[model samples]
Target: MSLRFAEEIILLALDDQSGKLRPLPDRALELAVAGGLLMELAFANRIDTDQKQLTILDRSPTGDTVLDSVLQTLPEGDTSTIRQAISRVAADAPDFKDKILKSLVEKGILNREEHRFFFVLKERRYPMVDDREEKEVISRIRDVVIDGAIPDPKDVVLICLMNACDLSSAVFSDDELEQHSDRINQVARMDFIGQALAKAIAEIQEAILETISYMGM
Candidate 1:
């Protein structure tokens, strides 16, 4: 397999073993192995043996629990040899190793510690709610309302009815509705205005639905 793909598989395998989702170190041997350069090194006396305890030792003994976890995640069979080869190459090829480390860190798959790289599998990801499209959608809705483009009463009512039906079936539970009775009542009071706005929203919604139907949404 290709060195890059092998490196990726090693990371994935380690993560699976360790139950942590962190990037692997940018060892030269790792790059070589990933690039398929390490088979020769593995055969030569230059590399140490592969094993779990040895793998842990190979990584710079820096108390990196996350890194340790990932190393431990590797399967029992190929773990030791791969780990030793990675350690030896990384130790030997500082410049190339550093480059790989930087790439992993920059990609946010690895963290930095005392100039060393650590992996994190469970990286945080923000929800799509903060996307540009969501922002623009909200902005447009506000602009339309503020600009006094009130929708027709029938459309407004239909929109509110749709929301109420959807909420009843898909979102809010009966217990939640009862618990938030005051807020529900306040929202209920806005049904009249919502109905008015719904007319225009309904047209927009219908147009979108029609477009989606044709476009295979």
Candidate 2:
């Protein structure tokens, strides 16, 4: 089976040489993973969303365990806006992130390692055993953003998610990103779901920043 968007985000966040996750701002990776899950559901036709609300179109399992579990829990209604759905999923992000990581390990795409800090603290890091999937994801994005190739909706969503999570630097150098920034923004706006996800991520990030500023005062 293909890797889900959440799985892909985790893979992209891994440092190739260190076999450790890159340092990201608070809640960046988690919210991206959460948005990824919801994005996957949207593409699976199990759910749909518009500017005002997210609706559950079908509750039937996608046969993907993690997604099925999430889908099953989404209350049947268009009551929640897309942002609300993201917040709900992101609340359990650390747990769901683990689930996606383990799934990648089971697929033999990554190897999990443990290190003991001072023989008391345990740190788990994943090193890639196979990078084929990661390469494919990067390639598709580059093609669309750099070569001006028509983007698949999934690729467009990937672009938006990476930018939303501030993971763009992980995928491109500052120069390349600057040069192609327009294309990146263009592709990112192609999908309504991607647009909503980015907007929601921005609002949440802003709220956190505001809270931190208030606390500092």
Error of 2 at 134 (Å): 1.1
What is each predicted model's overall lDDT from 0 to 1?
0.34, 0.87
TM-score of each: 0.19, 0.94
Q: Write the per-residue lDDT of candidate 2 for residues 1-217, one digit (tens) a residue.
A: 5878898899889998888889998899989999899999999998887775788888887988889878755655655877778888888888899998899999999999988878875888899999999999899889898889999878888899998998988789999998999888888889997888889988898898999899999
Task: Flag regions of model 1 displaced more than 4 Å.
Answer: 1-171, 174-190
lDDT of 1 by residue, 1-217 (tens): 1122222322322222233323422222233322222322222222233222222224332243323333443344433544333344434433443453454445554544432237544343222211233233334323323343454332233224333222222223567546654543333335433332223333434554678788985
**Which segments of candidate 2 are over 4 A away from where they belong?**
117-121
- C-alpha displacement of 114 in model 2, angstroms? 0.9
Predicted structure with the largest lDDT when compared to the true one: 2
Task: Highest TM-score: give the candidate number.
Answer: 2
Give me the displacement of residue 2 in model 1, in angstroms.
56
